[model samples]
Target: MRKNERLKGKTVVITGASGGLGEQTAYRCAASGANLVLLSRNVKKLEEMAESIREKYGVSSLALKLDISRHEDIPAVFRAIFEKAGHIDVLVNNAGYGIFAEAKDVTPADVEGMFAVNVVGLIVCTKEVIPSMRKRKSGHIINISSQAGKLATPKSSVYSATKHAVLGYTNSLRMELAGDGVFVTAVNPGPMATNFFDLADPSGNYVKNLGRHILSTEKVAEKVVDAMLTNRREINLPGWMNAGSILYAIFPRLVERLGKKAFFKK
Candidate 1:
């Protein structure tokens, strides 16, 4: 198959799609000739994004006001997509939030909320879509994890934990579904200048340090669409970030020390 054949006429579902990486990905997917199902808590923004994609790329698109954390709302959303698009060829679990706090300082509610949206919501959405994929025997699931997914962070302990869980979860699911012709890949991105930091604990200082190294969401979005079209097992954009993952894997203590020093300088 040619490079773009993989994504042609495919229908992709993207959560937290109103802004940041999701919005940009939707536009790119449209350019690639893919139909889109954009979901997020912000309906107005999703609608505007859908209009832009439709006008610019002439691709069919829909906007759903979805809160990923709400488990009960998933089936209806998928049902609407199936009714309109027949099947979901790709599911991008990109809806996530961050909480910058010490392990002790972050509340139980904070931890729960992060997991609810980051982990639980992703699993629920995947579960909702998996049956159809199994029947078709073809689909792609891309989990948008963080660099913190592969390593622990200091102030952002809870946020890191959720991403770590996502990394492990995606890996395991990829193995289980490998023989079935369904592909699962995790996109572990480093810091990006998205609303992820804005959603951090308002009183927390976690984002201040991270903002210095943030990548452009549009750049990351481009990588995401390219990965989907190529059926890549996993992809880390901007090169150096993947190298950091290698270094962290080979020298845990060195990475831990660097992480601590970077976030908590004396």
Candidate 2:
């Protein structure tokens, strides 16, 4: 890899670093020579993952037990990263949860909890990091959104809303920081086989069929790292996802109609 292409010697902070895309991205970033600050609510898993990265890539890493749902935890974690690394070159806001339920079936608490991690928490983390980035006039902020960010799917009403908020936030923030040299990007992925399904509504078939077309967690991580290096603004993995976006944009009512049809058939 070219010097600019390599993540070597950079300090990156990744939330939701315990499993799935976060875990895979941590390992890949370490291999590319980026020192990592991995944060997740699962302390034991985070420690184990940190050890694996160190052993394989010989890169130093720190694991912080974090619950992105709790906004109060942001300041302290940001302080630790700043103190330890002097500056955070990249911030990957990947720690988010999803709740799969029809709008009527969704409770207020369920919606609130998802937003706490998926939208508000991401915003809070970015807010905490921006002062440093603005001072230096350089940094990368990568948010892990979803295909649902671009289109709504049945039973994903609340989840879709949160991701859509992320999409809007990323765009607006990117523009505001454009001249400041702070790059803000959003990574929107389609179906992926992860424990995300385990957290979704149990009766929902959304995960069953969708998970069948899932991409590998490692592939998603690689794409994320590539996006960071290239300074991409918005990325939809696997190409077909862009097609999905186009389809949704061109045929808004089509999805709702087809969704209801599919529901009846089921």
TM-score of each: 0.92, 0.92
For candidate 2, write residues 1-266 as lDDT tens digits: 21234578888899999999998888878878999999999989999988988898788899998899889989998998899889998999999878776689999999889999999999999999899998998899999999888977667888989999999999999999888888998999886777887787455565565555667787788788877745688878767766767776999688557556543321
Task: Judging by lDDT against the true structure, name the best candidate.
Answer: 2
| lDDT tens per residue, model 1, 137-195 | 99999999988787666777889889889999999999988877888989988877776
**Which regions of candidate 1 are displaced past 4 Å?**
1-5, 201-212
Model 2 lDDT, residue 48, Cα = 91
Model 2 spans > 4 angstroms off: 1-5, 258-266
At residue 36, give the lDDT of candidate 1: 92
